[model samples]
Target: MASSRWIRPEVFPLFAAVGVAVGICGMQLVRNICTNPEVRVTKENRSAGVLDNFKEGENYAEHRFRKYVRNRTPQIMPSVNGFFSDPDLPTN
Candidate 1:
């Protein structure tokens, strides 16, 4: 003879309410994930618009890098031992 623990009748309504709440929340979560811009931008959605975005990003990065390089001043730091830049080398 085996005895199983049976759920109390009063707890059934609580379980039912929790289940309904969980179901509603789960459905909402699924809808959000499906509709999210990042999630929706999958490889399957590839098009000219995606390519244009990538090209624009590359152009912007390259433009910023070029502007930085053009505006920055170059300087060589001397080592503590002063061995990296040879003092023996004649300066123009």
Candidate 2:
């Protein structure tokens, strides 16, 4: 067995937390650089007309995404209550 004389295990959580925070910050920074309307680093981005941006925003607003379950309450154990309560369920 090789004896370890390196970093302490107690500091592992701190390191993991720092890594997660750094990763989140990095993702947000990249997203802002790519999508933020005010950021016009490229020539094409700078040349885009205001009406084009307005149309893009309108396109996004007009398309509404649908959820899977409509007019239904969310449940932690989805089938448990239904299985016990359904009158027509087979009981053999």
Candidate 3:
């Protein structure tokens, strides 16, 4: 029983280290998913759908224009204006 108690104490740190490693890995995975281009595009698409649904007039041309403006604002403006920018910005 005394020997078992000593072993348990020794194993506690190992388990704690494993838990920390797993937590770090999970955080990294979440960060990667949040920053992924495909994930960002999907989120943008969903946001546009929500915005389109809320518009009062239901005009297709207006909805398209709004989506285009929203999508282009961060992407096209900086590139054309020569603002310092990351080259990996999503194109699609």
Candidate 4:
């Protein structure tokens, strides 16, 4: 039973290497997201109009995303036509 509880020494190094690689990848993804200019611009544009006032160093992405969503129409459902044929619909 004692022998069965052990991991092979060679396998430990492989697991550690994978962990290190994943950590590095995560760090790079964070860096890219934080530093991208287009993303920052889009966010800024949506939050405030192109001519709106701004405070120094304020992030505008949230406002920009909100404005963009507000200006777009909601998607129409294709199944709306089926509602007319429903048996429960009144003919009047």
RMSDs, each prediction?
19.4, 6.9, 16.5, 13.4
Q: How much is the lDDT of residue 45 in candidate 3?
A: 64
| True-vs-predicted CA distance for residue 76, candidate 4, Å | 59
In order, what lDDT does every prediction score? Answer: 0.60, 0.68, 0.60, 0.60
16: Cα error in model 1, Å:
0.9
**Which should have the higher TM-score, number 1 or number 3?**
1
Global lDDT for candidate 3? 0.60
Using TM-score, rank the candidates from best to worst: 2, 4, 1, 3
- Lowest summed lDDT window (length 10), candidate 4: 52-61
Where does candidate 1 clash, by residue pair?
none
Tens digits of per-residue lDDT for model 1, 1-92 = 22234476777899899999999999767855664333344557644243335664555446645877786555455443346557875545
Per-prediction count of colliding residue pairs?
A: 0, 0, 0, 7
Residue 27 CA error for candidate 3 (Å)? Answer: 0.5
38-90 in candidate 2: lDDT tens per residue? 66778886788454577655544444332445545778676777778887877
Which run of 10 residues does model 2 get worst, by summed lDDT?
Answer: 59-68
* Least well predicted 10-residue stretch by lDDT in candidate 3: 52-61
Off by over 4 Å in 3: 1-7, 38-92
